[model samples]
Target chain A: MKMISENVWEIPREGKMRVPARIFASDILMEKIKADKSLLQVKNVAALPGIQKFSLAMPDAHQGYGFSIGGVAAFDMDEGIISPGGVGYDINCSVRLLRTDMMEDDISSKRKQLLEELSKEVPAGVGRSSKMRLSREELDEVLSTGAKWAVKKGYGTVKDLKHIEEGGSMQGRPDKVSDLAKKRGMPQIGTLGAGNHFLEMQKVDKIFMPEVAERFGITKPGQVMVMIHCGSRGLGHQVASDYIRAMENKFGISHLPDRELINAPISSELGQDYYHAMSAAANFGFANKQMITHWVRQCFDKVFGSNENMDTVYEVCHNIAKMEQHMIDGEKKKLCVHRKGATRSFGPGKEEVPEDYRDLGQPVIIPGSMGTASYLLVGTKKAEEISFGSTAHGAGRVASRSEALRTVRGEQVKKELKQKGIEVWGHSSKGLAEEAPQFYKDVDEVVRVSDALGIGKMVARVVPLAVLKG
Target chain B: MKFKFFDHTADIKFQAYGSSKEEAFKNAALALTEFIIEEDIKAVQEKTIEVEGMDEKQLLYSWLEQFLILLDTEGFLLSTIEELKIDGNKLKAKVKGDSAENYKLTGDAKAITYHDMEITHDDGWMVQVVIDI
Candidate 1:
């Protein structure tokens, strides 16, 4: 590894690598990254045909199937390739924060009851059906219109769309989505699928940058907020499977470094089909969170006697591919940017960001582990120049699920959190154990690196008060 | 035991062994079933599934992926594999299981992945897969 700057390291372009691989991390984080296969995955991504600048990894980088979880790469629209591995299986797996008028102390006594109500209102766990079972036609509309469709169905208000990425809906062609994908997705809408998907009640713990926090509406400490982390559920998974099979059948690149890196030319019909289908799935993800937002409001109303006037802070997807024009070699070029386990961090004044936040920069929510503090960060202009405007998504895991389970039991974890005045409700003990806070790197360090590298700057921090995990 | 778990940083990893390739695939399916539901379920219901692939590698991939789709769409929790047959691209199997209501599901497996997937014949036959949860 060659040091490019203080917190950036480079894997020099080598055999079959079209470009160098870059990672934004401190020396300490780099040590951990070097110990995993993530660095190799970065090199593999650089090897992909027509990758621009470099295959970049965010501070929270970790080994994933083909692309590292915190991976980001841009491809030339006319000559590059689009691999399903770059987008991940859970299409548009994202985070949304809902700010409430109430404070933490006001809801402290009712935390347990609120958790119970949320658990009942939001369907979770394995093979759980959603409260809203849409017809085939309704599901297609959801695939096309995304959160806008959910809002039309009385799930949320139109004002919420303005704060969401892509204005709550991308350019999705519902016809591109297969019938089987619809079958799996139709019943899972509004449902929080299992494994790390969670709905947590949090309190404003600390304000790192008071000005940015104020601009983003984190006015005071102890202000209550809700963060939802989920995705398109089974529908996204099926779409990935369907496309990977199609790409493999059409382009038999068996000699490639990883079979999972199978891709189609971005200009090909197959690639266009995948782009449309994936956009539809991403819309499903957007609408999925919006529908759940409706139920979350209902849960609050059921617990607090009146609607708490929860407003959308911002919603952003970590897993996605978008067509954007960026400067390359001092010339503007259209590129397909793939960000898996990485968030889009369009800086201040970018037209893609919401108008209200145009001067303040986009709000990038990074959820920590259940027992840790999460951060709200703002994108930076420097990120757009160097990293294609991307940043870390979460505290990447250091310990495996089995290893975490071996060290502690879920009931014990729950007990410890309760002793600390945090209420946790999970469907299974094993699931809770697997998601133990100790399993992940400290989010504080990850954000610091992002700030140091000018990718993202910290705004506010929030700690979990009550957690509902699937 | 026909199957055992391994450590993968982000996903669930496991390997199953059997006397033949078909048996290995069966044991692999059982491993997925056990991962989803912790407790053993009775073989009260039966379903016959058929799939076709271009080769053995795809056959194994399609086999596991098909079962996952069934679990999501039909809620068919597996109790046991009654029979298995494979000839080139085609595969036929009969599996017995109960409805999802009869078992307590412990985990949610999103998909069967090709990441580091392998099938080999060392002593008998062995298959390894990483499931994204």
Candidate 2:
């Protein structure tokens, strides 16, 4: 590995690697990133045909199945490939931030009550299903329109849709999704599935860019916000599984270095079908977060009495491949950018950003674990040039789920969190213990690297007051 | 219950052991069951599933995926693999479990992965696999 800049390191294109693998991390973070096989996975991604520029690993990069979480790679539409592992099994695993007019002091007394209401209002945990079961046609609408279905269902005003990525809906082909995937997704519409997914009530502790922060509805310190983190549920998983199997069948696995890295050529019919189905599943995810937002609004009103002025700040998904145009070698090229565990950090003037915040740049949300600090960042133009408009997703895992379970008991973690003035609600003790805050890398440092790299600059910081885990 | 867990950085990985390949596959199902739910599962009903694959690994993946399908579609919590047979690349199994609502499930296993998956025979058969939870 060679140091390209102060915070950037590189593994020059070697042997089978078609492109160099670049990692954005400080010297200390580099050590943790190198602890696992994540960097080697980056090298492997670099070897994939038609990958553009460099295969990049964000600061929070950690070992995942095939492609490391926090890995980003864009591929040529005609010559490149799209892999299921690259997009991850959980399609559109995303985060949504709702800014509230109320402050910390306002909710201090009723914090636990609010959490209890949220815990009831929003379905969570493994095997938990919602009362809202969608029929084939209704689900097809959701798969095709994404969160717009929620808007039609009156989850939030049309203004709320504006703040979401891709207007909370992609051009999804519901026809491409299988009946099996649809059946799996049906009862899971408003549910928050397990593993690192949570709903946290947070308070603004600090603000770095007061000007930009104000524009994002963070007018002052001590402001309260709600962060929802989840994905498309079983439907998305089945879609990924179905496609992976199909790809393996169509193209023999003998050539794949890692079976999990199975891919179909982006230009192939099968690939297009997978992309459409994947987007439909992504739409399901959007509709999901939107519906959750509706229930959250109701819960807030029921608890606080006045629910007016609560609005969405921004929502972003870390998984999925997008057909985007980027300047490669000073020439614009249409590419399929796959961000496994990376956030899009597109800067100001991008048409994709909401109209209200167009001039100020897109709002990038980075949520921390159980009882930690989450950050809001301003996307940068420099990010588009250097890292293909991508940044780290979260405080990447430092220890395995089993390792964390061995280290601490759930009761102990809850007690520790209570000492920090944070309340906890979770489905199972083992699940809580598995997501102990210690298992994650320091998010502050991760954000620092992003800011230093001029990719996604920090705007405001919020700490959790209450956490609901699944 | 002839299975034990191994440390994986982000997800769960396990190795199931038995006297034969079929038994190893059955043990893998039990391992999956234990990982998802902590409570004792009563086999009140039985359901059968069949899958075909071009190779052994795909066969294993297809076979294990059926449990997840049952869980998602019918809310069936896995209790046991009552009977199993692997005829070349085709597999058929009878599984027994109660409705998932009867138990508290811990993990939402998204899919099974082929990462470092191995089905080996050395005296007793051992099959190692990782699941995306």
Candidate 3:
């Protein structure tokens, strides 16, 4: 690995690698990243055929299935491949930030009551079924229509769709998804599944770019906001498993470096089928988050006496692969961009960005660990030039669940949060201990690296007031 | 006591040990069940599942996938294996457990992966896999 810049390191193409690997990290973060096999995974990704430029790892990259948790790579349209590992098993696992009218002074006393209501309204944790059961046909519609299905069913408003990625729906084909995937997904939708997923109420603490923050509906310090972090539940996982088996059957894994990276050519019939199936799973995620948002609104009304005005600021799909047009060899061409544990940081004037905030750039919501401060950032053009318009997703995990369990106790974590004036409601104490803040790298440090690299600009910073974990 | 969990950065990695191949596969399933609910469940209902794969890795993958499907489709959490037989790339298993409503699930095992998977039966049966949690 060679230092390309103050914060950029490069691993030259060697052996079977088709392209070089680039990682964006500061010196302090580099030390932690080198402690794992994520760097090796980055090199493995570069070996994929038709890879564009360089296989990139974000500042928060960590070891995951086949790709690093914060890995990003764009593939050519005709020669590239699409793998379940690249798209992520939890298809379209994403984050949504909502702005509320309530201020710190207004909710300081009633925070506990509000959280209690939210816990009842939103079913969370493992194996918790949704209150509303979907018939086979209805679930299929959700697979195709995404959050729009929720809005049509009176779960949310039409206006909320504007703030979500892909307008809350993609070109999905439910027929492409297997029966097992649908069966597994039917009961899991409209739930916030466990492990690093959370819903937090936060108050804006600082506004670095006053203009951009104002454009994003973030008005003044101490303004309260809601952040929902979750994904498509069992449906996404099953689609990945079923297709991985299919791909392995058709194309053996002997030629590949890693069996988990089993793939199909981009133009193959099975590849397109997997794409549609993956899109359907992505839609399930959008609808799931949409329903949770509706329940959150109702819970606010139940707790506050008067309904609060909560508006969707923006939503970004963290783990997904999309067909996007970008400059390649001085010509605009469409390519498949896979962002696994990364966010799309499209700069100002991109047509893909929502019209409301297009001039100010897309709003990127990066959630930190529990009881830690989250950040709101704006996309940048420099990111498009160097890193394929991507940024880190979160403070990536640095320790295993067993390691965290051995070092920390759930009760001690809760007590520490209470001392910090933050309250938490969790479904399992063991889950809580595993997700302790110390188990993850520092989010503040991550945001600083992104800012320094000019991939994402910090607009505002917010600290949690209350946390709800599954 | 038949299985041990190792430190993996972003997922759960475990190795199950047994005196025979059948025992090792059963122990692997037990590790998955314990991840969700550590408490031993009472056998109130049973399921007979048949799994087919192209190879031993797929055999293991198919076996784990059956239990996951049961958890989501039937809400049946596996407790104990009443009988299991593995022949070539196919396996038949009869397992018993109660409904998910009977217990509190602690973790979500997203999927089984082929990354760093290992299976050996020369000296003694040992199977290693990573669960995408």
Candidate 4:
């Protein structure tokens, strides 16, 4: 590995590598990255067919199944292939923020009640189902229409659409999703599946860029907000499994370095089917968040009289693959950009950005672990040139759940967090133990790397007041 | 414990051992359930599962994936493997477990992955698997 710049490390193209591998990290983070097999995974991704420019990893990079988490790779649409590993098992696993007119003081006295209501209203953990269930036909509508279906069903207001990624919907072919996936998804509409997914109440503590924060409607410190982090649930997992099997069946996995990196040509029939199915699951993810947003509003209303003061700030997907137009070799080309554990940070003036945010750039919500600080940043043109308009999603895990469980008991973690002034509620103590603060990297440092690289600029930061997890 | 967990940075890794292939597979399944929920093995209910695969590795993957699907759809949590038989690429097993809703679950396993996965028969039967959580 060679240092390309101050923070960019390069692994030169060699052997089967179709492109060079680049990792964006500081010297300290680079050492931590090399301590594991993440770099080897990056090299493996570089070897994929039709890869363009470089296969990249963010500062928070960590070893994952096939593609390292925090990985970003773009493949030529015509000659490229779509790999399920590139998008991860949880399709469109994402984060969203909701701003409220209430200040921190308003929520201070009601913390316990608010958390209790949220825990009761939002179904979570293993084998959990939401009170709201859709029929097979209604589930198809959710697959196709995304958040629009929820709004049409009166779950949220029509005005909530503009604050979401892609206006809370994408072009999805519901027919591409299998019956089994549909069945599994029908009962999970508003549920939050387990493993690092959460709903947290927070307070904006600082504003890094007042101008940007003001334009984004995040003015003043001590303001209250809610962050929801989750994904497509069973629907997305089944789609990923189904497509991986289909790809392996058509083109045997003997040639691949890993079975999880299974892929089908983008122009092939199986590839199109996977893309459509993935989009359908992504739609489910959008609708899932939207429906949960309704429940969050209800929770807030129960605690603070009326929730009319609440409004969605923005929603962003961290795990997904999109057919996007990017500049390659001084010419415009369409590519399939896969971000496994990264978020889209499309820069200022992009047509896809919401109108209110077009001048300020898209809002990038980075949720930290319980008892840590989460950040709100904006996309930059520099990111469009360097990291495929993407940035780190979260403070990527540094330790496994079992490692965490061994050192810290769940009840101990809960007590520790309470001592730090952060209330925690969950289904079990073991679940809380797995998400111990030590298990994740310092998100403040992760965002610092992102800002230093100019991929995303920090706008504001919020610390958790209460956390509800599976 | 018939199995022990290995350290992985992001996901869960474990190795199970048994004197026979069927026992190894059964131990592996128990290890998986233990990772998710700490509960007693109550065989008040049972379900017969049949799966087809191209090889032993694929069979292991299919077997685990099927249970994960059941966990998602039917709220079924495996307590034990009452019986197990394998013929070439085909596998038939009778799994016993109570409903997940009645038990206390700690975490959710997303899906069983095939990354660096293998089943070895050195001295005794053993298999290594990584689960995406």
Candidate 5:
């Protein structure tokens, strides 16, 4: 195995490490890592109890709460540490795409109208709520049942669930979720909360792997697509907040360094409870995106006249922990895998993949920031060998929001994007400034790193045509 | 002292400039608390609450957030702050507050999150407090 490549370095298992740690990046990315403590966070994850194989970092790896963003770590179910930071505040923060038969030429003239309609139909901004406010019971059901809750409510078709990761519902107990978390989530079922979340209208620009593209049903170069990037919103935030506090004190019980890295053994009562609650919130996030997908279809119908021919490309959650099975040293073992700011990249012929896509491999949807190109990629078998079947999520932030706002004005960024023919919509100009294209690293570089590492293979490139931000 | 308002992604921030570090921190706390409760400081009476911290900066941050939390969750309108002292990393502050007839809270900030939070002194005796959204 190429443990240390041109930019990557592997920390071999020693002392407390149960497994090695592999970081995927170039020297340039590593320089950025040195400026921050994300590498230290990755190293900390390697020290956790019962960690398996390797703690992997994608090209976009950066400093984050407990586990660094773009970090992937797996642990045996019987022995492991589960920290809220590993999953992050936005429980199921994920990406969803919809492909249409319509071409770029068909929707060029209606771009502004489409953007306006989308902004109105999709609730956005901080504390934004949908027209449909659910009662406490309904909220619980949403958390417990996930996208199935929305489909049953007639928000979408059952077929939509098939294309979603874990069928859009992570099966587990919801009663473990706190009442406060339930209250916070009750009013925000389909809302798109602010900060880095967005809805972008795109056109298939180019095909890289024709075989994978054909399997994913993406053929024409100008075919229109819509991608929604969001998550569990307030409910998930509350869950994380409540649990971080719990862990802060609970980790004291177990005696771990760094209060920010507070955690409990996977078998502990506190850990099990947090996992159940986390899973419920993840479910809520799944249902939240599914509901928004329905409204997206409605927005498309308003513009294109009908959405019956539109199809869901895929829905995948990047911030989550899952119980999975992987081979370690030629022995198959069950492990709890934490993929924070990383996507599951199960290769072709995996059972978890949908029947239609089993031959094509899991679809890895990576949405670049506004004015940048998004991508569709397929999982590779090498990912299992390197990163426990995980890949980079997006163009990780290089500059903080404030840094972006200081360097780029919202109106100017908007002007530049418009000059490029990208239609943009959001609650405020200030919000737009925080998500300026300059705030992020080049996603093309991130994709290249993953491709070079053989974790994922690019299938298609998508350029934005219309955009919505919160 | 001169204070400037800045727009954070999810919160409004204030940067205060002063000849002394103590003044900078005190004013920063005042600015943040004032944003939570819109009221005239002259009209409110003063009652004090003491807070201690492990470090001077931590004490400053915790002191401000503690007061803000009281104002946010308990509806306490702070009027004045005094009796501040820092010995090594430890700090002690006596915060003054009084109940107002009616005050409206504008934002729904649950708590001061520690994400990317920072407090630093600039070259011109200006102190900046960056709060995570």
Candidate 6:
């Protein structure tokens, strides 16, 4: 193990570890990891084919399916492997931020109305789908095209696509996705499904870096910001499920150490097919968020009477794998980076970023639970050197939902959030209890570690004013 | 003795009572798997599986999830549970199951969810488990 810094450590390849392991955490975080099996999962990821540099973990790392939740590992295109667990079941489960010209005072009186409208417009809960339904052919196009499908459908503007990561579409063949996945996805596009999915109305409460905030068009304390957290919904879930089962069947009874760690080499047909389907789902997720953004604008218009001038700040997906070139061992090489429960933190001047904000790097939108402080951060060069240009996803869970329900009442949590002046709307009170802010670690602490490690630099802090939960 | 469905989330948690902790865990897994597959436990083909855990509670969790994984992946529904032995964190079990396609369940579970799950000894023995539907 190589200690890159006091907080970061590298686990060099030993035995079956195909690559090394890189961990980003403070001494205190390391203690927490030692108490959990997340570190072991990270080591297992290092064993996957095509992994380069190290299997990296962010500060908010936690045990998950195959790879640790806050993990990032890049594999070579020719030899790397992709696991469904690495991308997670949620597909492009992601976060989108929209900085508005209006201030908190402008919307405070309408918070309740705003939330109600949002809840009404955005379907939530299990088996919930939006009012929009697509034919089988349309669904196929959506699965193949990603956000570009939504733009062509006029669900969102071209400018919205420009601000999104990868131009809101990762180009590749998506015809490989299964028909079953497409069928499962057709009805769920533009819907908000359950389990930690939400849309929150927030205000820029603090600005940590004035220049960065100004460049991103975020200014004036109390300015309202909208954050939406959701994913590719059933389509993404089906894609992951389909591939996982296929992989298991292929490796059946093979004495694989873990069933969830099933994977295939990138060069194989199975691997390429999974990648195409996953990318399609990621694109669908981008389109889903874009559709939600359009509805959010409509909700705002109904409440505030105008959305003609509202703009999208940034839209990004946290759960995904992509092909990118990064400096590895002093030489740039192509790699397929898998980031689950982690966000890309590409430093400034990268062509991937929009020209206007190229110098400021990508805007990393990290959402906290409703009634907590969310943050907007920018990628740093230090992150490229250390974490393969990645950062923590959110305040990782400290307790499971069931554990929270034992002590925290759903009604009580709802009342508490209301008392805090945040309007809340949810499908069920029980769902709220599962997502109680107390069930997670302090998001501020998670962001603080990222800033301290110089992976992501904070730009602004946002506090929720209204929330719509699934 | 009695089954009570807790508040509706993605998973459904129910409480069951037995005379001993071991019995309670066994019954909980049986009930949970039954709830997931919505079928009679008598038709499944008998299969034995072993899972090692760190402690009795962890062992119970793994044991239940092992059956859950089977039910989820292979559509194997439990028909009969013959034995459950726990030695520290290690759990060994023999369960019978055929196919889940023939079994009728109240709901189809996507997978065994981590929403709300617990195994505790109360007056007799009580367990609460939530299955993702």
Which candidate tops lDDT? Answer: 2
Tens-digit per-residue lDDT, A126-197, candidate 2: 888986878899999999999999899888879889999999999899999999999999989999888899
lDDT of 6 by residue, B11-125 (tens): 3567666787667777877677655544355653777888875445445555666664565345567766788776666777787777754644433333343223556765787
List the pairs of residues colliding in candidate 3. none
DockQ of 3: 0.87
Which digits, one per residue and each the tens of the lDDT, describe model 5 over residues A1-470? 24477646787876665677788987777777666777777877888887776787888888776578899989888878787878877888999888888889999999999888988888887555567878778887887789999999998789889999999888746688877677667767898777778988899999998877877878889999889899887677777767776765555424543345667788899888889999999999889888889998998888879887567778888999888888888987888888999999989888888888998789999888878999999998888777889999998777766567678888998999999999888676777887888778789888888888888889999999988887
Note the Cα lDDT for every prediction shown: 0.90, 0.92, 0.91, 0.89, 0.77, 0.78
- DockQ of each candidate, alpha-carbon based: 0.77, 0.85, 0.87, 0.75, 0.13, 0.07
TM-score of 1: 0.99
Standalone chain B TM-score for every prediction: 0.95, 0.96, 0.97, 0.95, 0.72, 0.79
Candidate with better DockQ, 2 vs 5: 2
lDDT of 3 by residue, B1-133 (tens): 6898898877899999898988999999998888878888889999998999888999999898888889998999998999999999889999999999989999789888887889998878999989998
Candidate 1 per-residue lDDT over residues A228-311, each given as its tens digit: 999999999999988988988888867579877888889999999999999999999999999899999999999997665688
lDDT, candidate 6, A312-343, per-residue tens: 77876788988878998899888888899999
- Evaluation by lDDT, superior candidate among 2 and 3: 2
C-alpha-based local distance difference test score of model 1 = 0.90
Error of 2 at A220 (Å): 1.3
Evaluated against the true structure, the overall lDDT of model 2 is 0.92
For model 5, the superposed segments whose C-alpha errors exceed 4 Å read: A1-3, A12-18, B1-133
**Candidates by DockQ, descending order:** 3, 2, 1, 4, 5, 6
Residue pairs whose backbone atoms clash in candidate 4: none
